[model samples]
Target: MNDGWISDEEERTPQVTPVYSQTFGRGGGRGRGGYGENRRARGFNSRGNSWRDEGNSGGNTQRDGGNIGGNTWRDGGNSGGNIWRNEGNSGGNTWRDEGNSGGNTWRDGGNSGGNSWRNGDENITTLAVKKNNVGRIIGKGGSKIRDLESESGARIQIGKPSDEDYGMTVEVTLTGSEDCRQTAKRLIEELTDDSAPRSYGGNSNSGNSYNVEEPQEEKPRYIDFAEANRAYEEAQKERWAQLPPLKKNFYIEDPAVAAMLPEEVANFRKVNNNITASYALGQSPENSPIPNPVQTFEQCFSEYPEILTQIYNQSFTKPSPIQSQAWPILLKGLDLIGVAQTGTGKTLAFLLPGLIHTDLQPIPRSQRGGPNVLVLAPTRELALQIEKEVKKYNYRDIKSVCIYGGGSRRDQVNIVKQGVEIIIATPGRLNDLVQAGVIKVASVTYLILDEADRMLDMGFEPQIRKSLLDIRPDRQTVMTSATWPEGVRRLAQSYMKNPIQVYVGSLDLAAVHSVTQRIEMIHEDDKIARLFEFLHDMQPDDKVIVFVGKKARADDISSELSLNGVSCQSIHGDREQCDREQALKDLETGDVRILVATDVASRGLDIMDVTHIFNVDFPRNIEEYVHRVGRTGRAGKTGEAISLFTREDWSQAHELIVILEEANQEVPHELYDMSQRFSAWKEKKNEDRGQGRGGGRGRGGGRGGGRPRW
Candidate 1:
């Protein structure tokens, strides 16, 4: 009767007391037939036909001497019915009675003696689980649950779906023995381990559990309009704080020469002299001498009077800003890195310095076999051009030779063996000559790298390094480029002694002011027609240079132009050295009015009287565009540059707009609109990349967007 709540461990063993009664009732009464009874009996009673208790010697039964319900029994008397009694106090256990008319029947209404039901019919447990892990617990088509049931011998019943809005967990009921229930619970715990809530951006902890719900995406924190504007202003201030201070008008002075300039001449110089210069002293004595700059070529030639005659003979009036500043540094035999607008007398800046140094210390016949000065250029055309400038100096005692590839190496060796004081050559051919023992740099005192950035871009760094290995360590190194990129800066730090940097205008990549740019958005198919139309409007005397993207295109365009009655000549890398030289010569002379070429002619090609440049195909980069436009406006002459762009050039529209705006050129409306579109696309691309999506447009890749080279 004490079955209120019994634990499995506590129900293993129980105690019971036997009872004998004739009729059971819900009352406490004593009778003669009762074998065992208590005054306060709160136990079970079973209904039966009859039961008798006698004081027999063989059976263990107790007889009460009290009457109950007016019934009595005699002691030591045997009844006509069968009587059964379990030995030792086991009589109160579950008893099965076999009647003559039927099978055995178990009556548990009597005292069960604290014995538990071993059939496991009452063992049931319910567990709450995360809804996300219910699928894993149930598995594919209930396979996992069936396997779990078979392994643990437990029947699992999953309850109704969870109400996610209220954060209700799933209910799962398990019915089995203690061991089976414990095993099933452990398996479910392993399955639902990853369902626990995790902090944002934290890694999952459960091993190979895929039933966890994806974490909700956090909303982006957007700043208000006022806050965004404040942040932008602060960022602008920080950026400006990091920039170097601007340099003002501080021209070098030369006291020996005096020349009174007309108002027009002075005005011209002032309008064009937008040069910026910075000087850093190399490892030298505290009192190391520095030379003063000059205002005019006459002042620059005051110390070297012989150079004045050469300058006058060449019809040179005055020095450009770069030459005006660079002349003094180079004359003092200090290292210099000159950056100036293309066609702004950069060739003469270093040339005059080298020539003056040569004039000051004339190399003897014995010391002349090896050149005292070595000038390395990036391309053969540039090297040849430098050689031509050297010739214009007309140094009688200072002999110089120009050597490069795509020409006769044996002939160059013969020239080198004949003896020269200055050797102007490209890096590859010069390195080859030096390795062949035909050229020696041990006696070289001056080293100049013209278009140094272009040389590095053309993969000539190794050759430049090899040429420098045998050169004298105390040599004065000079590097000159129209645009000074970071690579050029690093090159200077590695090779030059604390060098002086001389720049004209801002030291940023931009087109020259003298050249007027006209950009047209046209289709590729219409380019030829546009070129013809442009040529028709051009003057006959105006020498024009047309730039194309590839060598084959150069040839094709040149042929088409020639067929259209526009006398033209093409030159590229694939042309023979003699043919290419002739083509350039024909263009320089009046033999051909138009010259079509690739980027090969972008740098160091100084043809006189060039009035216009046509970009039949746009250059690969802004720098190349600057250099190409620079081909026309030479020697301070104003010129025009016209470029045709297509859809392929969209990626470069933003940069092109910036260049035009910086140079004060009129930007076309189409270009500005395309640039805006490009900006939006760039922003979207960056956002995608930040969200773990793939990015676009790697550096120096893709069509029309690769690194521009000459």
Candidate 2:
């Protein structure tokens, strides 16, 4: 043991004064003797007899014979056996017994203690134990001490810490006969030793082991939230400052295209900071000149003949109404808000000018560092559709990629790493990629917020705002929406400068004029049978879209149609992106004759030659109804729309009538009757409540006196 492991009591040297006795007997002889301090006594016997001796402090005793034993007593614990016994007080004591067939015992009741051992004979010694480990020697409520005593046939006593050691070390004394002292000492050493393999919270093993406990872990400290947020904002500002500056107000380089315009067109664009028109319904800065609408494709793309050629190649003879006004405003490097119905050529209006802006930049495309144009869409399908449109008119070798959720992120990241000029993306995935450093938004100069109203309605405004934080504020922004709601107007005010407004049709909720609207008043249970009856009239080459309110309903209708030998497929938010794409492909390739879908497909998908639209479930609101009807009658093509309206949809009857009458479609008398009945029932319920509350003077009481407003 190390010196630090020893205590003052354990270093004492006993003052030995030897006393010897001899006894001879054939049977047995017994004798007991007590000695004073620091004395040694030994007795020799011939036959079956035992000698017991008790000694004072710092004393020793020994007995030798056949069945020999020794006993010593100090100020310590007690033990009784066949051969020897010991009692001691304040000092260390040693006793040894050598014989053939007997045992020995030693006890120490001193301020110090004794340790016992056996090597061919029994001896008593002293042991010093660290104060912290004394508990392991004794265990819970003395249970482990009793168990050790029973197993080793020894008495174990745990004493208080020694005074000379300043209570840093405890003394554990053992007393026994024969080899039991050795067994008990070894077990105690294993329990108190730090290197011993410990079994926590269980019984000690019989072989050689002990139960030891582990220490508890420390708790975490508190954090300073305000300081953390300040550091984060400073880092963001540093990153933004490192990006290159933005260049603005550049135009197309073709002098020939510039010459086609009147001299007034060139001077007006140079002088004014905003664009406006008398035909559009929006406000701008005072005295902002409205550029004249283009009359022909030659006028729209006169600066870029190649784009003009591509436009004519697609067989578009003239510009659409929104196009005629939007082209001149965007090409002049002014921000614009185009309010037009779906399928009115809004994609090409922003896309063409964006291509021109990108190609005409002072910095070359290769040196732009990242994509120059970012288009934020609300849905993956719309982003992909915009990508398809972008692929058709390839001007100046500009490439585009669509990024959205529910698609392979690895593939998208790899494509972004390869340089591209235009990035069409949904807001959620675009924000994710920007945060991940897969996309850098600092280089974007031309930004498009398509379907602005729909994006807000779908709860994507937070994502949209986050995506625009790193983009340059002076870039030309274009916002297109089917409806000019307050949300879209607010977004335009925050993002776009004093922008030109070009609206093709009326701002009120209206469907396409090219589609003939039809409505059938029927019971709820009769819708499926009526659907089959409508499908019977479908032409062999004609494609149709069935709009339902719920995804489950779409599946139900598609399954019913397939069972009756009609080919159909379904698409909704729940379907995988691959499956949704396959369904659209199947419908477009003439592999499926009908597509049943929710309003998710209603907003901006431009599927060609859709001959009919069936509203198996009425849309939740009339705004969706307009977009759903606009799907079939696109690009001046004539189509038909049929709807099944039941009594459950009475709340929307008035709005539905307004849309039908605005489109000049025929309305059935039964629908008018149902509308009247709903109004009457509502009025009656209000009157009943009024009588209960105001003594029959209510607004429903035919101008009766309730109260007067100033």
Error of 1 at 641 (Å): 0.4
- TM-score between model 2 and native: 0.61
Q: Weakest 10 consecutive residues, lDDT, candidate 2?
A: 24-33
- Tell me the tens digit of each residue's lDDT in model 2 across 341-385: 888889988998898888878777788899989998888888999
Deviation in angstroms for 114 in model 2?
58
lDDT of each residue in 1-710, candidate 1, tens digit only: 23422224223634223254232322123343233321111222232121223322222221122112111111222332222222112223322222122211222222323211122234667788877778877777787788778777887878765576465687788866779998898877766777454222111332433444658779998869998899987886675444322221122345442233444334533565665555643444456533444667766666566778888898878887888778877876778888876788888888877765554454454643467778889988989888888887787668888999989988888878888878999988888988888886776777888988899889998888887775655668899987777788888988888788877787778888889999998887999899889888988789999898999989988888777777889999999999989998998888998888999999989999999999989888888999999998888788999999887787789889888999899998888777777777667656655775465555543443322111
The clash number for model 1 is: 1
Q: What is the lDDT of residue 126 in candidate 1?
A: 79
lDDT of 2: 0.73
lDDT of 2 at 663: 83
